[model samples]
Target chain A: MTETSGFLTSNGMAIDLTDLTIDKAHKHLKSRDFSAMELADAYLEVIEKKNPEINAYLEIYDDVKKQAQQAQEIFESKEENIVTGIPLAIKDNILIKGKQASAASKILEGYTATYTATAAHKLIEKGAVFLGRANMDEFAMGSSTETSAFGVTKNPRDLSRVPGGSSGGSAAAVAMGGALAALGSDTGGSIRQPASFCGCIGLKPTYGTVSRYGLMAMGSSLDVIGPITKTVADAEIIFKAICGKDKYDSTSISGSINAVSPKKEYIIGIPREILEIEGIDKDVKENFEASIKKFESLGFKTKEISLSNIAYALASYYILMPAEVSSNLARFDGVKYGLHKKGANLLEDYLNTRGEGFGVEARRRILLGTYVLSAGYYDAYYNKANDVRRLIADDFENVFKNVDIIITPTTPTPAFKIGEKVNDPLSMYLADIFTVTANIVGIPALSIPSGAVIREEKELPLGLQLMAPHRGEHSLFMVGSQFLGE
Target chain B: MITRTDIEKLASLARIRLSEKEKSLFPEEINSVLGYVEQIKNADASNAKALQKETVYNVMREDINPDESGVHTKDIVDEFPKKEGNYLKVKNIL
Candidate 1:
């Protein structure tokens, strides 16, 4: 089972653990083809070789062997669950009790979580072994992992280009076979955009379908945790495991997920108005059109519709997200639990602790948020943004009445070179133009690696994004699986 | 464009000290981003129905007496950065 490519190439062992998907891995483990310990070791071997170049994992759990030992015991006792012995990577922002979850920022350096995030807790209870915490944008603020306080995570496909952001490390880990699957939160395209850039499947579940409890708050209204996996079925499996209500988060809903079996009928709507955006790469647009044609060949209907208000989605999100960020991030003062720097007095302490703790992008957003929420400007900026947000949601509601799912290019371009737009924050934010509307409307969306385009003799992946009506994840998986021919 | 004086006010309100360089740099960045978000002003809200949040509601939990609910008061208090036995320590404002 040794191979020149695709997982465990460096190991050159007879037992190839890299190519095993979730289903195959479960079958092999159940049949005792190899022990769970063996599987964990094989992944650890790959991480050792690849992580230095990729920088995907921030911290590999020291207790991996101990966790795998417990998982092996569970498997031997005939208590196997959906994710038994499955080693998954977690985003740094998600909390696991007694673990250093820093969200890749200096503000919470050396901070340990006192309790586990409800999502991670659910997986742990099912005998899933967390391999490590993945690196991400500091405070989940940027579109590229370059903003991370730790280091920039390079794209596994091309070392020079970024692996997209916020969830860049999670997507890269899964793409490089370092982890079978990983969890990432989407606030303004953090998950899907990276999932696309790194060539993986990333889902952003309908807001409130998955509990946000214990995930370090970014944009509170825009964040939803979902899975980044190698396959759509794996995404479905992880989604079901983590999607449920918890009393800890009042926003979570109980069993509100759409249970309708994916209908065989396929009617995909394309927002012609939004698709005709400026600055879309030639290859990306051509590939996007080619993906649409592939859907047509598979007996799916394609309709060109107008979602005119979608043009303003990015604008609305920028305003609303910062406004919420300014408020949510106010808690990290020099008090209680994180980094505390003493100064002359109370005011100086607050200023010094925050000024030194927060990164440039974070401080910029906070100031922008403050300005928008200031007394005289509140109605002009924040309120107007909310009204436009309502309009964008209404546009989706109207378009969805005639279409099962809306399709778009996940990003305007493939992974860009690191430092290409780092200095220009607005240009950096434009990378999320196509992916942010779903967050704005509180709907389920996914980014599936559509195809690849070669640049500098390297194949960088491009993703096709699909947006479904509220709780319409079933439709996304249905169409997504069909498109991927899984 | 927002002036440096306005940004100074924002920094004071946000309680974050900005250096001389940041004071100049942040205003330019903030103003550019504001320019981008200014497009929202075109959407009229005068007659539109108030925006409704799909998932926000007042949650009520049963009042469990401390005896019935197993509360770890010590563990909760231990999370504070500076604690004096069972109480939290903070700088005096008076």
Candidate 2:
């Protein structure tokens, strides 16, 4: 057997799985340097070797070989595309027909999807292979994958630390060389935060840009299916495949909305107020400053702008996200699908099924959501949060007039050690501060690997977030590609 | 501040049976969350109603079966906790 990057291929040939991006893999597959089966086997080999320690995948799909064979046929027929043979990890919340999609909760333990999510379906149509369902926070609730019933997903960079949630598994899989790329859902920074921690490129497409037909809904207004990959170009490839209007989701807009041309010289906006926030990590701040200087050196102009309502973004999101979550997740009763428990009566059945099925974080959010939406508090909390949401949207609208993009550190700090903030929920929620406003305002945001810092003899990766106006994913892709020198 | 009584009420409304440990622990934990989110009270939302009015619109579609009838019926029916001959069996409300 030969060795490449210290990894061996199944056919006694050397292939570096760590260096393979979607584009590079497509080129290699096109040239017949290696077959699709070899690529899939290389990744599967890595998953078998590393997934036990990382806990990145909850279930490795049984049909991977079959899928690779189909991709091989496409290459033989000369009908292959960029993702024709790419092995991808899908987060647990996304559905592929007849596959178990548990959202990393016991509630959906045995539930099989009756239909495929539009995004995953698009990727499958393009001949991508499904590796498995990646682990995530239950109902996409927690900032760390610690809330998942399966297990916590540790960062590949440092085994002691968490690979940020709720798309922790997706990010970790790519970071650990287990998959070329993965699909993840972002609701309140779920995708971006984890990408930051794992140093992958995560793109939360413009809200309603990608169809959410078969996705397990968390917050209807905030959820968007996105891609986590090694490069911004890979993310763009996946985004283009999945985004468009669909009859199933009425919120999905037509393709013309995102058809804007790229600008010659883009102006970037930096929110100065973010630096004033408490608990801003020193490395994160220094890395952000260096990123700004790097952008300036690349001939892009930077302006100090203000998002006045941004300070209220995290607070507003807590109220609004849970409010939608309580309503969206109410469908998980025992009478339908998922886990069921016998009790004295119908009410007890729901109570037992939901109570025992949902983890502590899910229960907390449900209670918090119920409290805010209940009588006597609805006007004060729920209604007020909506008002603040409108103001945040307005703040974005006002800022986009002055600049083409807004930049921030994806998280306040790099990946924290697992179990470090589990007991303290508020501190865990603080991890989402910089990444939430994009969701709050329904804009597209991308997290690119900015730099890293040494922590406890391990170099932990950090990310910089770039947000654009609604349907302005073009700007994000343009700047992101330039920033990463891709 | 959230009290134990409020937590009980919320748990009941949410249809979650909290254990004694949760009942003891949730008050402080939830209070911390609510206390942190309490900062939203400072936002000047006088124009919030106007902003809300601007974005509200009904999305309507022609009522037609997008897929073949019964294409997903069997799969959905197979998942029922209690089922009888294509019918979902549930506890009698009465």
Candidate 3:
């Protein structure tokens, strides 16, 4: 894929991965053309300069210099890894060994993971430097990261609006030059939504694709940890390193993923229904339709497809997510660990700790999860919701037979003002309408930064989400590369 | 038909306290939110179940090998409101 002509092709210190793909970056580093420290220093300098404007990171690791020093040693040692010395941000929910894994909640504030997550550990082995932890929605809830306990993560494109939730900080961190790439957990659109809102590339892998061993669970059935970066190629690089079987996470497919994306690819699927959403922004629609024409011009075939069961995705997602949350969150009972409060009795202490520790949106979700998963309502709601979950999965099973890849608008509208839909749960659910269907049906989806929407003379990047069936992520990369040209 | 009563009970179950205004607001908020769940109250999913875990009943491998991973009890408990000796001291249970 070649560079888009209209894009700002400035060669600067904040050069995105797409400018010089990870392969070029590594090839230069390996051949002693540019020292690893120079690349690390270039990214660190930008983050130091611009992070104050975006607030994408809660904290930047001070040990980055020491890690960079180690990367030089590995280069001198001539160790083999695809991304030796490249910097990446670990979304706070995914543990980075000793780093504070806050999940943007007060409860785990300052708490450190004794052991590293499987994915983080893998990257460390591959010689990737830990830039820092990115912020997210408290326990991966809400759409806009305004729900973060520490503070809201703003859209890099527009300061007034929000970066999308659960992985907003990760998306914005990369968008504003805080890090080269990041890892974010996507359960019910957490990764892809924020990527769209903040104008970065975020991949939500198929359900069993990535390990969830270290992530603070928001919804177990739906959660799959994945990459958020400045381009589709970078996403594929990170995904390759962290994916495959893990004994620690039973849900993670304990198998192998492609060592590299195959060159040959097939036609892309453009679901017609997604473009017809009532509130789909005109710019998003125009850009997506134009992108389709661009794909056609680039020798790719397009088809009108429908998976009507996607309509019920919100219902299935809310039900299954909460049910999983109800079970996963049971561990934080103020006894074994997490935040505790002063009280005269055990029960009161539990109440106060949860009250003070959890943010508003977390409380709302816990209550919602409890309401649906409660014993009396289980059969009437949760049980039936599971039944629909099956239908949603089948819908995908049927669709993959006809298309090689799926395409849709990553978000219905561009990033909204911080408080626009905070109070309205229905609108918030609708925010993930296009993204969540992939999670419900367990398919790999990527939200690629198409181009910015310059509204009122200000620019906000809109995303186009591409999905491939389970383990078919390569198809998206091959097709996406045609548009996100170098 | 969620009510203030329902919100209060739900809050109690969740072990949190809502203000009078919040308590009053939640029932309507929750009811309307739950109204969306009605979309999947019933649907055909004959195919999805085919992919579920093969074994149905408690697939628990007998924890004969009690998880050897040493979780520092004090490491977790020390992060509490108050501690007495070794354990986290808390309010009454009932």
For every model in order, what is the number of clashing pairs? 0, 0, 11
Q: Report per-candidate TM-score of chain A alone.
A: 0.97, 0.98, 0.93
> What are the per-model DockQ values?
0.64, 0.81, 0.49
lDDT of 2 by residue, A54-115 (tens): 99999999999999999999999999888898999999999999899999999999899988
Worst lDDT 10-window in candidate 2 chain A:
A1-10
Deviation in angstroms for A452 in model 3? Answer: 3.2
Candidate 3, superposed: residue stretches over 4 Å from native = A1-21, A259-265, B42-94
Q: Name the docking class for model 2.
A: high
Error of 1 at A410 (Å): 0.5
Q: Can you tell me the DockQ of model 2?
A: 0.81
> Mind giving the per-residue lDDT tens digits that candidate 3 earns over B1-94?
7788877787889887667777777777777778887777556565656756442343234557445554655554555546787766655655
lDDT of 3 by residue, A18-137 (tens): 355567778867876666777677667767766777778888898898887888789898885877888788888888766788888898877767668988889998789888888888
lDDT of 3 at A64: 90
Worst 10 residues of 3 chain A by lDDT: A1-10
**Alpha carbon lDDT of each predicted model:** 0.87, 0.91, 0.78
Instruction: Supply candidate 1's per-residue lDDT for A269.
Output: 97
Q: Reference contacts recovered by each candidate, as fractions? A: 0.64, 0.86, 0.55
